[model samples]
Target: MKIGKQDATYQLERFSKTQAEFDEHYEKDLQPIAEKLEEERQKTMSLAKEQAKKLIIPALVALAMIIFFDGFRIYVIAALAAYGAYLFKDVYEQRKKMRVKIKEQLLTALIQFLNPNFTYKPKSYVHRNQFIKSNIFKDDPNRYSGDDLIKGFVGNDDVDANGIKGTKTELSFSEIKAEKVEKYKDKNGKTQERVTTIFQGMIFVVDFNKDFEGLTTVVPKQKGLKISLPRFLSGEKGRRLEEVELEDMEFMDKFTVRTTDQIKARYILTPGFMRRLYEFATKKREVQPQNTQKPETLKEAVKVGLNVGGDQRRASQDARNVAYFSFRDGKMYFLLSTGKEHFESGLLTPINKSLVQEYYEDINKSLELVDELNLNLRIWSKE
Candidate 1:
């Protein structure tokens, strides 16, 4: 389904009506704390800026004087003066730490206000093992690092049309990033290394209600003859499980499927389910802009390459690269590498109703994936 501003507005209205007391509590209690933290952050930044001016102005003046004099002695003196000014680096670091602490405090308070059952950690992230298990990205521990983890439950003891009662679905999501080092010799014969991002995005894991065995990985189709040839030649050794051709030719063309068992794969990837995945992938692709414009200058080309290199690689793997699904160890993992930081607001900006509602809506979008894909449909397993 297309998630637009209407969904956000409706969710906000419903939340305002059902959770009026929570809003009142936030205004009364959390607002003061956030204001205090913002005030402290402003003061800290102002002090740092003042100190930077005091240090930098003198250094700039000394450098200018050295240039005007055009003497070796003056150059040496200016260099020493510049080095001395660097002594205040510790103070700058301290200011940065203070600002980060304040932001963490504000974020924590806001999250607590939003859902008492949920927890947020500014410095913590989903473990690398979990990422590898998810099979969303290439399993490379050396390249993975993440933070900004949030975990909680969504449903309660709510009854449904099928006479099934809702359970507390355990959900955890975090920002994850991976990088690869490109070591090459420059034209001057000097070795240079460029750290390029392999994958940068959020990963959300939901505990599936059904018990199942085997691993199923659904990945975007690999294009180009050169890339597809290696997998075709290597057979199953290339880690490409027997490709299950689906009934939907369009879906089959878009995604390459692999499964440990063909029978189970057919059971899991039903026509209805494949249609939902296809729609979600198509929606994400439609929203992404196709930049056909090329860089006008050499410098612009280099800059553009540096900025979009990782994106290019990710797109080659999956055009959208926004959402990926894998089932392993009886848990449904949604690897969403949209390259956007969700649930984060500007530190200086005051938290308003709209901002909070936006955060709620973004999270709801992730949670809704479980229902959207009908992941809890447990016909095969006796849950």
Candidate 2:
């Protein structure tokens, strides 16, 4: 599964291959790696089950003690937790080993298999500064960590930018978790700390085909009565952003825009551009294993929007409209709140063809954003 840098570079042109072609390539090139991974998967599951069986007797005894003798209940509960962790240490280590192997061997190959132009980094992430610069989320998060970084470019053969046909658009996305802590005094005068999640999802950044000045941010519209307010009036810092009203009713129904330059915002969000955004937001592109009774949890997040100050508490399944995007620095920053880690082999599931297909589909769906947003067509040159 070790792909040399030169080979990967040579295969950069394969980014345009269709899913059927990928399936053909997987069968021909990746079968051996998949078989080796299956062996590791089976061994890991057997070890986990053996460890689980050993815990049953002690767990039942602890449960009986808690039910019969309530005096030592708290101590027994704490002891049980400690004992469980100690007993499952081997299982945890085994699973971790299996996880890393899959990431290194199978996942890495699958990424390059899709597009060798793309580089997959399981340990690196998009920087928090880039997140801040996005200007989509107002609250700054103190804690941030991410992995499974995929970076590369895809060319639209039919589109032109500058003097060149087939414009190459750079795009990258990774799973990120950003959180902030707040300290507030309770009614009893004891200070308590609460950790609020600022944004927990995929941060997708892509090269904008057009050049525009200032920053334009589009976020999901607030429910109930509608009122547009300036960013400074609403306590936003830096650029003075004023809300831009659009003519499209459906676009207005789905989003609200704030921009430092009103003219550029209007120019960027044309009726066609707005329709593409709305269509992409509402599209049902969920990637799950086919025909599985118990599919892995790859469903869209209920609360995908930025939960600033712990304001958005309810889980909304129709968070398709819960997207955030902004234009700045010759790039379009897009955020999809898919609050789950994708493309990892399940511990209990076999690492077979279906698992590999699932991985392919997940990355493919994300890459589809390029086509969905029509990012390859240049609208205007930089001033």
- Counting clashing residue pairs in each candidate, in order, gives 0, 0
Q: Give the TM-score of candidate 1.
A: 0.65
Model 2 per-residue lDDT tens digits across residues 1-383: 12112214223232344678778978887778889878876776676567666767776788899999999899988987787677667766766777788778888888887777799889988988888778776576788888888998875445334444456678888878888888999999999999977776678888887876678888887685222333641234666878888899998878888888888888889988898888878787553222213333312111111111122211234333246788886889988765455555446566788777766766775566776676765344232
Off by over 4 Å in 2: 1-17, 156-166, 187-190, 224-238, 287-321, 378-383
Pairs that collide in candidate 1 are none
Model 1: per-residue Cα lDDT over 137-185, one tens digit each: 5434467777778898644545677776545457788878866677899
lDDT of 1 at 12: 14
Alpha-carbon TM-score of each model against the true structure: 0.65, 0.77
Assess the local accuracy of residue 29 in candidate 2 as a C-alpha lDDT between 0 and 100: 75
Cα deviation of 158, candidate 2, in Å? 15
* lDDT of every predicted structure (CA atoms): 0.58, 0.69
